[model samples]
Target: MNQRLNRTAVVKRAAELADEIGFEQLTFTRLGRALGIAPPGVYRHVSDLDDLRRAISHNSARNVAVVLSSACAGLSGHQALSALAQALRDWAAMHPAQYAALQIAPDPNDTEGQEAAHELISVFASTLRSYQLEGNDLIDAIRLIRSTLHGFITLELSEGFKLERPIDLTFERIIIALDAMLRGWAV
Candidate 1:
């Protein structure tokens, strides 16, 4: 533990490294090497590997939420939904690990982690409201859209598509299908 380092810097670098090496490959030793500190020094900033993972999750959620929210700004209904869909895909393409981080369920007692997750979902929930959906229907809609987008993006990131069709075209069709679903979903 030499030189000065803080949890914030450590977390930031870890998140970057997560995007670089995949979240599973991220390790304190690698992070330490990048930070020019001993692996033990990371303990000074974060309690342990799990704690650092939590911090990364929180950071990733918050960042993704902001990106998605901005993408849907001043738009509603199908337009908002489409903006959100494309933005999410673009963000995931750029930061697959961070996007994957959003999939990690927050611990029940982790308020900060819970809040970050909620904010990301809220972005989708708000856009769905444009279709005049609410109550249980709204919750279901959010889950559906999240699941749809998550499944598609995950497969795409993993190169599971393996088709000759342009990926963008498939994504656009998905947005069109979602728009149609939401329009009828209002009833």
Candidate 2:
């Protein structure tokens, strides 16, 4: 019970630290200091840094799932995809550190973490299913949409599109491309 509670507290603090400092800088020692606990104390809760990272990944996945699911409600196909895309970008913008934490791949053995990731992906995949997509075609569309969104958002967050054109225009263009892709999706 004590370890579980400590793990919970540490995960919560790590999340806040990620929000404040950034996921890239989040470390066990930093997390310990943030919680006013010794570094070793954290080990009683988390096995090591990787464990802490997993916790953060799991936490952010759940958070993103909530955001995506809420945006996907009452929408379908391209409409749903647009809502999901905007929500993802907004969430990443609002929670850069947590968002970065979520970018890490969850361990295949960690079913809970994988499930959390799946929840978010399913929100996107389910939208495609509305168009009666199946097998490789459906998977391909999901990959296309996800990769497109992820690449664009990741670049935007890194300020890659710092040219004269407004980023919003570029984002709008992406939406158009996604819509066109959906229109041409194999049945």
Candidate 3:
């Protein structure tokens, strides 16, 4: 807290605060208070709240890419898919606020944000490569995987599931079904 707060440090702290509180509650005033600085002092690092949100979003995307890449290392196909899916679910569960940040689409004009977003997509696309998918097929497969995983994780995070059956069993069954679908993917 003694060192001069740089943009990177501010963004990192903002992400941590977002995880502690919720992203919606994150603001320059809150961040400044956390950093023991005035709101104007925070402006030296981030221009405003939207900028901070973008920074958080970019960081979230990069973090997810790193996690997914690590999870799928030395693995491929169904093995990779299972690891990647579980890693994503674990990440979402652990960092609900940052995970929410990841759900926001980056502004098209923001190069860094776009690149970070693409990095996440590339991780999923690479995992699906073993299925021999390419072009639109590859894109669709990526969407399917993301949508399925995101849907379940978001629902679980919101406590939307009211079933008596165990969620873990349901998640495992989902992975199995996805594996089968990937194996049988045509076109």
- The better candidate by TM-score, 1 or 2, is 1
Q: What are the per-residue Cα lDDT tens digits for candidate 1 across 64-139?
A: 8899899989999889999999889899999887787777899999999999989888898988877888888888
Q: What pairs collide in candidate 1?
A: none
The candidate scoring highest on TM-score is: 3
Model 3 Cα lDDT, one tens digit per residue, 11-119: 9999999889898999888888888988789988888898999899999999999999999998998899999999999999899999999988988999999999999
Candidate order by lDDT, decreasing, is 3, 1, 2
Look at candidate 2 and tell me the lDDT of residue 1: 30
- Model 3, residue 130: C-alpha shift (Å): 0.9
True-vs-predicted CA distance for residue 2, candidate 3, Å: 5.3
**Candidate 1 local lDDT, residue 9:** 87
TM-score of each: 0.95, 0.91, 0.96
Give the TM-score ranking, best first. 3, 1, 2
Please identify which of the two predictions, 2 or 3, would achieve the higher TM-score against the true structure: 3
User: Best candidate per lDDT, number?
Assistant: 3
RMSD after Cα superposition, model 1? 1.6
Weakest 10 consecutive residues, lDDT, candidate 3?
A: 1-10
lDDT of 2 by residue, 4-104 (tens): 55677788788888888878788878977877777778888889888888888888899888888899898987788788889999998888888888878
Model 3 whole-model lDDT (C-alpha atoms): 0.91
